[model samples]
Each structure stands twice: as structure tokens, then as C-alpha cells.
Target: KAVICETPLGCFGQTICYDLRFPHLYRKLSQAGAQILVVPAAFTKKTGEAHWHVLNRARAIENGAFVVAPCAVGKVEGGGESYGYSLIINPWGEILADAGSDSGLINANIDLEEVNSARMRIPSLRHDKSFQF
Candidate 1:
């Protein structure tokens, strides 16, 4: 992963919709020096509306990393409507941009430098380790 660190973290961490439910993976990636995560999802409106944005933000805040989720909007042929709320959240739980209730590219011009700064300010990423209790 560090080999392509200059390529931008957002471009590489794109995962399926269900992957967001797993926070440990993000934690490991963050500890390995990942600063941002990308999730491309096509969740059913019923579920997306209930949990999508909140979960996305939660993951960002918990792992102290940025999250960019680009979700499919509109109704699919065989499925119900998809909740379209693409988001770009910062480490401090700030929503840089949110794509709410519509379909289009929600562009966010974030300072990639913030990731390191945020980590330094909080310094949580540098403190992770396995523990037994």
C-alpha cells in the first residue's frame, strides 16, 4: 500500500457496500498508514437511509481517517430505490461535502495533508497494538 501512497488513498481503498460494516479492517489499514478510505456502494434505500451516512462518519471518526463514499442513487431494475448520500468526512467528524437526495458527482477539495496533521494532532494511529486481557 505504501508503494502507491502518492497515487492518493482515495483512489485505492474503494470497497463494496458491505465492507463498511467491518471497522477492524479500516483500523488495520489506518495503522498501516492509510489516511483515507473509499467506499462505492449500491445499498437499498431501506437500509441506506437508516444507516449509511451515520456509519460512514462513524468509521472515519473511530479510525481517525477520512472517508469518501460514493453511493449509487435512483431505483435499480430489480431492486428498490438506493439512498444517494455520498459523503466526504474528515477525521474530526466534519462533513466536507455531502450528496443528499440527488444524483451527481459531489466533489470535495480536501487537503490530503490534513490526514497526517489530524493524525499528529490526535496521534491515535501511532499508538495501535494488539492486546490481551
Candidate 2:
């Protein structure tokens, strides 16, 4: 299930690690009026290197919503490493901030109005159609 929280800034939708793989979940959240999607992940270094950035940007682009992903870095308890590179992406899939491989902080100024602008320009969400087979 998808959950959303309404705030003064925007309507945020939450998802944890590994949920990044599923596009339908994001679509559900966006359909429910989510203007921002938050993903807090502890992705393995291997997978994150391969998929993290692209997946985050894809979600934002497809949904016309912002994606804020704060990822875990450094060594894990079990042995492998957690990939860092925390990201703050915009509705147009532009990377606003990226906290490279170390554990630190990164921030960006987000305009909720960009959500409306991006959606207006793309209008893909409004074009969604039911498929019958």
C-alpha cells in the first residue's frame, strides 16, 4: 500500500529501500496527489551504483514530482558497504543536490510550483489510459 502526508510545502509520499524498483507504486502515489516522493534507503553498494540515480530520476520524471532519496553510506554491520550519494531531484529529473560517497548533509531549494509546471509541460499523467487484453 502507498501512504501520503500533506504538509505546508507539499504532499509527500513515502517509500523505503528497494521500493525504487516498482514504478506502479510511484504512479499510485502521484495519482493520489503526491507532489514529492521520499525514499530513505540503505541500498547495497553494488546495486546502488548500478541503479540508484537512474531509478530516482525516473520516478521523478515519470510522476512529474520531486524525489528526495537519502541513502546510507560506509560499511554495514554484516560486511558489505552501503552506497551513499544521497540525492535531491526535481520534477524534471534534474539533480539538485548529490551528497557524494561520504556521510554528510546536502540541501536544495525546492519550489512546489515546479511540480505544476512540469506536469503541465509533460501532461503524461493525464494521458494514462486503462489497458485491456
Candidate 2 wrongly placed segments (more than 4 Å): none
Clashing pairs in 2: none
**Candidate 1 TM-score to native:** 0.84
- Residue-by-residue lDDT tens digits, candidate 1, 1-133: 2221436434234456888898777777777666777778988889998899888998888777788898888989976888888899988778999888799878777776777677778776667677899
RMSD of 1: 2.8
Best candidate, TM-score: 2
The residue-by-residue lDDT of candidate 2 on 3-77, one tens digit each, is 999999889999998899999899889989999999999989999999999999999999999999999999998
Q: Which ten residues in a row have the lowest lDDT in candidate 2?
A: 122-131
TM-score of each: 0.84, 0.97
lDDT of 2 at 18: 88
User: How many clashes show up per model?
Assistant: 0, 0
